[model samples]
Target: MKIIVNAEQRDVSGCTLAKALEELDFISTAIATALNGCFVPREQHAETTLSEGDRLEVLAPMQGG
Candidate 1:
């Protein structure tokens, strides 16, 4: 399936958010995820289903002074 990740097009084989994240190499537990502009809780990633043309945003915390 094809989806937009952080504004870039990507082809993923996973049907669920969790699997997609794994396939995308987003292994950090400290990261945040949003689907189609809606916030998705970490606990729900496994059950969250993704579809073609869906927008997926993955954000990670940044360290700054």
Candidate 2:
């Protein structure tokens, strides 16, 4: 299905949030995820389900010296 991922349109599939992440090859080191404005813990990804029109915000950690 076509959905907005971090404000960009992309194709993602699977029955749950965990599956979608796997399908999209979202690496753990690259970002942290918030679904519909709520923070989702890594351990809860498998328990969370993705629904239509749900907004996802991916926050990428930056290194500062």
Candidate 3:
């Protein structure tokens, strides 16, 4: 399926958010995810379903002083 990740188009095989993260090499990284403008909690990632044309925002924390 095709989805937008961080403003870029990506083709992913996973049907759930967790699987998609793995496919994108972000499974082990600490990040925040939002689906179609709504926040998806970390605990729900495994059950969150994704569809074609879905817009996802994956945000990683930045370190700064």
Candidate 4:
């Protein structure tokens, strides 16, 4: 299926959010997920299903001294 990941268009065959993150090699929980402009909680990642044309945004938290 085709989905927009991190503001970029990519082709993937993942059925769930967890699968997509695994396919993309994302392992850290420091990043936030936004699906189609809605912020998705980290705990819900495993149950969220991804479909064609879905927009995903992975934002990493920044820390400064």
Question: What Cα-based lDDT does every candidate model obtain?
Answer: 0.99, 0.79, 0.95, 0.89
Global local distance difference test of model 3: 0.95
Summing lDDT over every window of 10 consecutive residues in candidate 1, give the lowest-scoring window. Answer: 48-57
How far residue 25's Cα lies from its native spot in candidate 3, in Å, is 0.7
Q: RMSD to native for every prediction?
A: 0.4, 1.8, 1.0, 1.2
lDDT of 1 by residue, 35-60 (tens): 99999999999999999999999999
* Residue 40 alpha-carbon offset, candidate 4, angstroms: 0.7
lDDT of 3 by residue, 1-65 (tens): 99999999999999999999989998755899999999999999999999999999999989999
RMSD of 1: 0.4
Q: Give the clash count for each candidate.
A: 0, 0, 0, 0
lDDT of 2 by residue, 1-65 (tens): 76677888777777577888878877675678898888998888899988776777777788999
Q: What is the alpha-carbon lDDT of model 1 when measured against the actual structure? A: 0.99
TM-score of 2: 0.78
User: Per-candidate TM vs. native?
Assistant: 0.98, 0.78, 0.94, 0.88
Q: Between candidates 2 and 3, which one is better according to TM-score?
A: 3
Arrange candidates, best TM-score first. Answer: 1, 3, 4, 2
Runs in model 1 deviating more than 4 A are none
